[model samples]
Target chain A: MDKRLALILSEVFRLKEKEINIALTKADVGSWDSLKQMDLVLTLEREYNILLTIPDILRMVSVAGIVDVLREKGVALED
Target chain B: MVALVTGGGKGLGLVIAEHLLSNGATVVVVDRDRDALDALPTSVFGKCLDVTQPEEARTVVASVVKEHGRIDVLVNNAGVIYNEPLVNIMKPEGIMHDYGRFREAVTVNLDSVFIMTCAVVEQMVLLRTKGVIVNISSISACGNEGQTAYAAAKAGVNAMTVTWSKELGRCGIRCNAVAPGFIGTESTHQALSVDSIKHILQNTPLGRLGKAQEVAQAVATVIENEFINGVILDVNGGLVI
Candidate 1:
């Protein structure tokens, strides 16, 4: 996982860096509510300097899904 | 802070804009009247656009963002106080209130707020700008007599203010409305007859009409207070009606 992506998720959801994993989904995080989702989307947009569509935003329900969406948007998300 | 005020070319809106400017905000005033827009102070950035049109609102909002980087606050003060009885018993013909005028009042009072808020909020969300929206409502929202359309529109404005505050709070956006009572403004005096003004004064606890600056102060208070959200604050002088 990209260090920046992991750090953003950790900061946005107020979780430990080690807690961020590809297997983690929004349902697993108690703090991943609508507000947190907006924060995540904003943080990701700022970090990647990319605009996300509604579909892309909705598809980012899990870490793996977020990775896939970023990849589809031409974001390498490499370490 | 960059503040955009609609219908800010004259009356109470101008007062609010100037007050915001005095408070160190870069103020942008938009009005439909070119003459009024031109009459604004040089320090204010005046743009002539009808706020009721969604397309025009979007275009103006985009231009404002382009010029000022982002809008930190939006004051939806572009509205007309349309006074018409539901039915005029003395009229010989067409006694009922004109439907066309009612629609126009709604369009100007309620639709402008919705349209401008949509455009500004879209920009704020996309830019991730933490912003405040201050909608200028009126005491008439509580169902003022002889102002069916105006009252209905202001009530709608109050509803939108609450709804947007709940929806946008997560986005770090606050929505609030300042409902002013009868103020000693040119428009207010022009709208109400001498007897009507006397009646209002007698009923008001303060025994006088409100000043525009007081309403401006209320607006500034809501804008400055970070914790305030979805509040339909009344700037009236203890006048319920």
Candidate 2:
């Protein structure tokens, strides 16, 4: 699950998988603007087969935040 | 490319669909008229549905995506040409335009475009398809006198086209409108009086009605050109100029 999440982030942000980490935040990524944020939200929703709320989307500014939001949405992130 | 054209069963929409098919596109046509859908060519896919309803729009879009895998282009062409002056002094009573009729026109013309676009755009984004949207606006969008509802609806369509072009460009989606002038379609003839058409011809530099094929070609051009976004291409033969 971790690897998949990293892959999605890398693909959406155009970053290397090695560059993605739990510490990575929107500020740390150069391409994590509003547009890419929408892409990320869509990608995660499609990948997890879950609909995200506005608060869930806003809370997902960092990798750890994304994981927390997923968990809150009943997405089991533990490998 | 897989193209979905609403109101493609007859008239200008049918011509547009055929033009796309000739250009090697897989065209799916949806219209509210069942008889018209039944008359479409065997090569084109036809579905009967009212584009104004959100659920029906979503369902048709889903079915098309399920069959063709993705929708590359969506042409919003389903609309009614409503002509009524805001005030008709000739009438004995109710000189003002009927609010119900105005609402009906706006619903069919503008709301249908909104509903269909949302449905197709969702599929395009989810499938990651770089898609194009071509809205069939009218020359009346600039505010013709006897067409309050039609003009307002088409102007709204133009605004939405530009707005979506900016919003969806990052997602590899392009939106544009083709505002055709007095096209020599049956509907155009039915909509205008003989004197009105003559006046239009006198004002237009081309001095003739536009062909349906010409509008279709404009649609094709916008779809094929990768950089033409948020443009309202006028196919009016310099009528408004």
Fnat of every candidate, listed in order: 0.00, 0.00
Interface RMSD of 1: 24.8
TM-score of each: 0.75, 0.75
- Interface RMSD for candidate 2 relative to the native interface: 24.0
What would the C-alpha RMSD of candidate 1 be, to one decimal place? Answer: 24.7
Q: How many residue pairs clash in each candidate?
A: 0, 0
DockQ of the two-chain complex in candidate 1:
0.01
What ranges in model 2 sit over 4 Å off? A1-79
| CA-based DockQ, model 2 | 0.01
Model 1 Cα lDDT, one tens digit per residue, B85-132: 786433435657899999999999999999999999999999999999
- Where is the poorest 10-residue window by lDDT in model 1 chain B? B87-96
* Predicted candidate 2 versus true structure: per-residue lDDT over B1-241, tens digit per residue: 9999999999999999999999999999999999999999999999988998999889989999999999999999999999887865334356578999999999999999999999999999999999999999999999987789999999999999999999999999999999999999999999876656877999999999999999999999999999999999999999983
